[model samples]
Target: MNIARPLIQLVSWAILVSSVFLVKALANDSTQNLSIAVGWSKPPYVIALNDTGYEVELARQVFKRMGYSITPVYVPYGRTLSMLKSAKVDAALTLSENTATQTIHLTDSYIQYQNVAISLQSSNFKIKRPNDLAKHSVASFQTATKILGKAYADAIKQVPLYVELPDQRRQVGMLLNGSISVLVMDVNIFNHLHSALEPIESRQLVSIHNIFPPSHYHVGFLNSELKEQFNRALNDFQASQAYEILVKKYHIFQEALSTH
Candidate 1:
């Protein structure tokens, strides 16, 4: 009976050790790592330096709040949608509602973009409406036609000289060099690019018009459950001071205008 008691005690100790290790393993498994697709070198949104930007920080905070870790996968803007559709990434950030595919679930708007038409102050251009763009040479970001809506797309079709470039920087350069009479881009992005220019050059550029309405961007997710969780977390974030902090840090509301 003495040997039997010791044997039973040994078994209990072994079970306790096993349970501890099992719980630890399950804990590790419970902490999920989410991958998010973001555009490369899109300043104030996806800065490539340390993979830190407004959207990057926002996503990090949102997922962290939801008890998960996030990894941002940088890709070109055009490829982000395909990557999401193919399940290459858990979600894609900074996508407008007009651009989101039907198959993927979209979360609430986490960011807003003020897209505008820019031209040189010397050009004497006036772009009060989409139709007004038909009279000028234009350069715009890729997929902008679809995202800007059918009216803008139809207007661009009427433009005799129109080109869609993949890089915002190139569009800015083209506008400065007089290669394109007008450039369309987010106000923040234009400001970011303009800051790199010489003071003399910056003074000459101007945002002619805010033809396109402000676009609200959402995160696209292939998994519906993840989208629901993100929306809840995003709503909570918007109600918190953290959201205001991010907006101010990024200068999100500042309209696109000439530096001068």
Candidate 2:
């Protein structure tokens, strides 16, 4: 009937409309679910089971604004990287330079600071200055290696680094067990862990006053699509004063290590 060309055109238009609807529906579904990787323990920035833990709440609010339902996975800092590298997770709470994954995209600094060494209260190691640790063995996470390096020049001799602990609570464990003369950690994190993780004998610990290696913390994403969305959302958070509230809420950059 010589009607093939018109029929084909009509069919093509119908297919285009159907495809558009399908894409929109899929995108909508995706927006409702967001799964992220976070460490399982509390203290040093993230607290498990605490409604207001910095990393947990930050992830919840950030993703929620992007129209995503939050899925929080509790894992160690090292495993967090593994999850992102394998594309098993969508995002992570804290991103460090040590992670070194090519596929992971990072955003601007969401948190930043220096970590200090603390001794058990009985140890009497006063950290009143930076170089005071020239004769002590220091334990720290792998991510803290560079940060520690900036503080001590011949760091290998004075500051010995133990392997990264599974979580921040281990810093206290090492101190209690005498595995390390002192442990280096961000002050805010040190405080967070001090109050929430475990009950340490009050007389057994003391944190140094001197700070070391001022650093910045960042948020990370696995895919470019989510990365772009988070960056935009983070900017809005800053502009809307929510970032300030978060900083105060989490006490983000403020050091909480006062000799107690």
Question: Which candidate gets the maximum TM-score versus the true structure?
Answer: 1
C-alpha lDDT values of all predictions: 0.83, 0.69
Q: Put down candidate 1 lDDT per residue, 85-158, tens digits, no spaces.
A: 88898889878786556688888888877788888888777678888999898999878897898889999999
Error of 1 at 227 (Å): 0.9
lDDT of 2 by residue, 46-159 (tens): 666754476677667777788898878878766777787877877776777655456778877766666666777677776766577666777666556544565554553565
In model 1, how many backbone clashes occur? 0
Task: Tell me each candidate's RMSD, in Å, in order.
Answer: 3.5, 6.6
Over 4 Å off, model 2: 1-30, 50-52, 98-102, 120-134, 150-154, 157-163, 176-179, 196-207, 253-255
